[model samples]
Target: MKISYHSPHEPNCSICKKQCRFYDSLREHLIGPLPKAECAKQFSERGCSLCLKVFPTAQQLNNHRAACQSLPPLPAISGLRPSLVNKRNQAEKEQILEESSNKSNISGIAMDCEMVGGGRDGSLDLCARVCLVDEEEKVIFHCYVRPPIPITDYRYDVSGIKPEHLMGGMPLKQVQEKIQQILYNGEAIWRIRLKGGKAKVLVGHDLDHDLQCLGLEYPTHLIRDTAKYIPLLKSNKTSNSLNYLTQSFLGYKIQNGTHDPYEDCVAAMRIYKKMRNEDHSLSATEFVPENGVYSRMRQKELEKMSPEALLQISQSDFYCWCMDSR
Candidate 1:
């Protein structure tokens, strides 16, 4: 492949794809062929060489590498990091957010959860704090959670949770119910499932982990995860953190100290709103799936189907919650 040098007019960023004024080496990790400038600098810092993406921390990049499908495996990567890896395992909950559902009442709600360590080694995630915000960025609910397991590590450096803070804290069950009330707007989950009751879309970063830790479940289609958003993904197709995303997209810093759940919620919601407002168009021909119900069918079977029939089996390359806004 003919490798090109970096163009002054269009310096590519591996993660956000925003035009950079200077050269960035991370573009090498993209699926496309070699570009103008190959990143010649030897980065001593922990970065995914495959994608030329540099993260704020080694642990963050390590978390990204596991989910990067394009990169080949490396040796002795840290497994001690939390399961930010499988955050992309899209649940079939999309069926519930069917285009026919009502979009009134609450459009969406942003949520953030602070975790403390639990279990024998203090490795398991326990939701120690939770915060919910409305579309107007008002805090609807904020509370400390008394984890089911004894706290082994408050992770004070990040979570800011203290032993005293969780004292007489709300139970996990209560937290779940309260969050559900805000999400479901007093409607039962079953009604939302059966009669097409539109629950507010839950917005957050790496929300799967938070939902799992809280023992909560919501329709997959109603989830607006910044971590899995296509435009927010790294060039290597791995997830970016709420911090990096906030700073890059929103022009601010967060999680710089003991993380604030409200701050995180605002960041997630802001990004979601920005994405939702973006002007874009989708064409079926441009977003063909390589392997799915439509692509796997035999030529004869496909030939027998009508245009409307073909449309029924089609799917997009990525999920965009903004489509629902239309």
Candidate 2:
């Protein structure tokens, strides 16, 4: 059955990038009535029946399925059962993650913030808690925030925040200072912004909102927003929720119960790493120097271009995470 909400996190077809309300809808788009011709053809050749992921070749698909079948079921983070699936998966990935960490010079820091409602009718967002994790998914910082104004609504239904948690929470000013200091990684903010220093790349889903709630700012070029990444977006080009993106890409479900900032941080970091690790075929040299060439093209010309062609001309605007590997 197709999902009805048309959630912002709508699942996108792995092959053609068409947006669908759910996996079932994606399956329909791939192999159902009135299927997309190119996508359907590609899906039929290499798509995984279980996870709907399309592999690059028949041999890889067979190998992936054999391993996929024997793997433990993906743990649902939404369950309040206090299971170890997320942890176990993280532990398993450490071996893989270490391969990258052992050699890479990148400084990627993933963070997430929980907001509580303030002001009249509790409409204003106040930073209630925040968590930051390194590439290793190790918690570098995790603290409940003491908002300037009392939290009128803890948003506990989602945030799981309570008065007790804020009783000794870190002050907002201090939290901001700490986060900025960590992100700046000892360099002055100005130095990092001018590309003169090795500022940590901040990774998160919907970072704009989180940064706003925390009253902090960072250089846009140094930020990696998983929500805004073109490839991770819904076929309709909307941002997918962290929950959907995590389960789809990370092989686990999260944000299922009491929201854990750590879970979200880890999810965004894992997705960033996953995308970074892909063997993209395009060379940076093939791409146009900037995005201006794309805007100059007529609509029909744009429409006629293939995805690869458009990508070749969209170097400036996209600034995709994969390019960071360079």
Instruction: Give me the candidate number with maximum lDDT.
Output: 2
Identify the candidate with maximal TM-score.
2
lDDT per residue for candidate 2 within 1-326, as digits (tens), equals 11123222334677766655445567668778898899888888998764677899999998987754322223223232222322245455445344333333548989899888999899999988788788877766667788998778889888987787676677889888778777776456788767687678899999999999999988888889988876677757788888887776656678776778888888898878877765444533533334434333455565786764554343323554666887
Candidate 2 Cα misplacement greater than 4 A, ranges: 1-33, 36-45, 49-59, 65-106, 283-317
Q: What count of clashes does model 2 give?
A: 2
Q: Which ten-residue region of model 2 has the weakest summed lDDT? A: 1-10
For candidate 1, lDDT tens digit of each residue in 1-326? 11112221223444444343222223432323554333323223554543345576888877976653221112111121222211212242223222213335558788889899988898999998788777766656667788887898889888877786776577899878877877886678899999998688899999999999999989998899988776577766688888877765565577666777777888898778866764434434533444433343455565786754454344434555557568
Error of 1 at 301 (Å): 21
lDDT of each: 0.64, 0.70
Regions of model 1 farther than 4 Å from truth: 1-105, 282-315
User: Estimated TM-score per prediction?
Assistant: 0.62, 0.69
Backbone clash count, each prediction separately: 6, 2
